[model samples]
Target: MSLHKDHVVRWNGISLGLGGGVWGGSVCVRLLGWTQLNDLEIVLLLALFVITPLALPFVFFQNKGPLFSKWTALVVFLQPLAAFLGGASFFLPAGPLAATFAAGWGGFTGLLALLGLVQLCQMRRRHRLSLTELCLAGALLYLPAGGAWMVLACWGLQPLGFGVHTDLLTAVHFHVIPLAALVITGLTGQALHNRPATRRGVCWAAYRIAAIGVLIDPLLVAAGMTGAQITSLPDLDTVPADLLALSLILLTLLGLRFVVPTTVSRVAQVLLTLSYLTVFFTMLVAGTYVLGVTTGAWTITIAQMIAIHGLENALLFGCCGLIGWRLRTGQESQRSRRGEPCAY
Candidate 1:
C-alpha cells in the first residue's frame, strides 16, 4: 500500500487521543457506569475498538511514505483488545477451566511479547516496516492467543514453568510486560506520527517498558485488580523494587525534558508529558517499592486511583499532541526566526 506522509496533518491526535482516551474512559464506564454506558461512551469505545487502530494504518496508506510501520497498526489495535479481554475476564464466574483459561491468557502475554521481539529483529535486519510495527508485536504479546495460537500454545502452556518460579512470573507478567509495552507504544507512536521524526535508538527503550506498565493500569482497574493488590505497600525496602523505582525516576527525568522548548508547548501537551512521567515513575516507585516485595496497607483513595489511571492514558495521547505541537511549533518558530516562507 502507498503511504501518505502528509495526508492528515493533525491525524496523530485522532489516533492517539482515541488510544489513550478509550483506555481511561473504558475504566470509568465499566466500573462506575456499570452496564449503562451512554452514547458518547459507546462512541469512544467503538472508536478505540475499531476506528483507532485504523488511524495509524490510514496514515500509512495516506502518506505514500512511512507514517507508520504496518506493525504499529497490529499492536496498537491488538494490545487494547488483549487488555480488554484480560480485564473483562475478571468479572466472569470463577471455575477450574475458566481460571485455567484466564491464567493461560496471562501466560500468553509473554509469548506475544516474544513475537513482538521477533518483529523488531525483522525490522533491524530487513523488514520494510517502521517502528510502529512493534505496536502490533506488543499487542500480540499481551493479547493471550489471537496473535498466533501455535505460539501461544508453545509458550503459554508452561504454567508449571511460571508456577515453578512465581517471582519470575510476577516480574514478567505483573511488572515488566505492562510497563515495557506502554513506553514502547508511546515512543514509537511519536516517531511514526512525525512528518519527519528521528529514530530514538536504544535510548528510548525504558519509555517502552514503562509504557507497557502504564497501558496495563487501566486494564487492571477494569478487571478489578486494585493497585494495593498489585503492589503491597507495607514492606518498602527490597533490592529489586528499589532498583525499579530508580529506573522509573531516571526515565521520567529523561522523558520529561523532552517537553521543553522544542517538542511541545500547549498546556494540554505539557500536562500530558508531566502526567506520563508521573505515572511511569509512580508505577516504578509504587509497584517495585511498596507493592512488589514489601506488603503494606494498600491505599486506593478514589483521588489517587483516578489520578494514576487518568494520568498515564492522558499522557499517552498527550504525547501525541505534543509531538504534533512540536512539529507545528518548530516549523513556525523556524520560519519566523529565519524569515523564510512556511510550508503551504
Candidate 2:
C-alpha cells in the first residue's frame, strides 16, 4: 500500500496500542506486589502511551511539504515505539541498562522538539500567528522538558527538595498540563478554523487568548516553583497556581464556545463536547485544589486530586478530544473528495 497519511496514522495507532498494552501489563505486575502505582504515575503512563501518540500524527505531522519531510514523518511515526521502550524499561530491575532505555524516550522527544522549533522558525519568518501552529510548536518543545524531569525522577533526584517524587510530579505536570492541554487547544482551534473568522473574529481572538494562556502559564508556574524551592516561600506557589487556574478555566470555557460547530460528523461533535465538559470539570477541581493550596483549607487531598483530576484529564479530555479531531478531519477529507462543501 502507498504510504498515505491515513496509513501513517493507522500504523502509529497500532504501535501506540501495543505500547499501551505493555504499560497495562507493567502496571498489573506492580500492583500484584501488594502495592500500586499512584494515580499520577498511572496517568503519566497513559499520557505517554495513549494521548501523545494519538495527537502526534494528526496535529504535528499532518501535512507533507518541504518543511515536513519524509524522514521527519518516519521519526514521528516511530514515537509510540520509543514511548513503549521507555515505559517498559521502567518495569525492569533498576540498573544502568534501565536508565539507558528510559533515556531513549527523552532523546526521541528532543528530536521532536527540534522539529517543532524548525517549524516555529518558519512560521516566524512568514509572520504567521496561527493558533494551531503556535500551540503545536509550544507543546512539542515542552514535551522533552517533561522528559528531562522524568529522567531525574527515575534517577531519584529531587531538584525542589519537596520530596523524593516531586520531580516525577513535575514531569507529569508538564506532560499533561502544558503538552497535552496545548495539543488539545490546537486541535480545537483547527476544528473551528473554518468558522467565518477573519483576523479579528471572535473565534480567532479566542484561539489566540487560549494559545497565549496555555503557552505562558506553564513557564510562569515553573518559575514560581523554582522560586518557592529556593526561598521556602509557600506563597510563591500560590500565585502561579492561581494563574494556572485562570488559564485552564479560560481555555476550557473558550473551548466549549467552539466545541459545537455544524461543521463535522455527529460522532465528532459528541466526543468533542464530552471532552470539553470533562476538561471544564477537571479545571474546576484544579481551581478548588489551588484555592486550598493558597488558604491551607485542604478540601481536596493530593490523593483525591490525583484520582479525580488526573484521571479525568487523562482519559476524557486527552483521549476524547484527540480522537474527535481525528474523526472530524476524516469527515472533512471525505467531503472534500466528494466535491462537497467542508467546514474544515
Query: Which is the leading candidate under lDDT?
Result: 2
- Model 2 misplacement above 4 A: 1-7, 26-36, 93-95, 197-199
Tens digit of lDDT per residue, candidate 1, span 1-344? 22233323334444455456655666676678565433222332332233334333322332222323443434443445444443333344434443444444455455445545665566676746554454444444443432222222223343323231222223223322233334334443453344232235544555555444444432443233223335643232233344445544544554454433334336634644654465465655355334533454555442353244333433343334334334544555678799975432
Candidate 2 collision pairs: none
By TM-score, how accurate is candidate 2? 0.90
Can you give the TM-score per candidate against the true fold?
A: 0.44, 0.90
**What are the runs in model 1 whose C-alpha is more than 4 Å off?**
1-87, 96-115, 123-237, 265-268, 280-344
**Scored by Cα lDDT, where does model 2 land?**
0.73
When summed lDDT is taken over every stretch of 10 residues in candidate 2, the lowest stretch is 191-200
In TM-score terms, candidate 1 sits at: 0.44
Supply candidate 2's per-residue lDDT for 249.
69
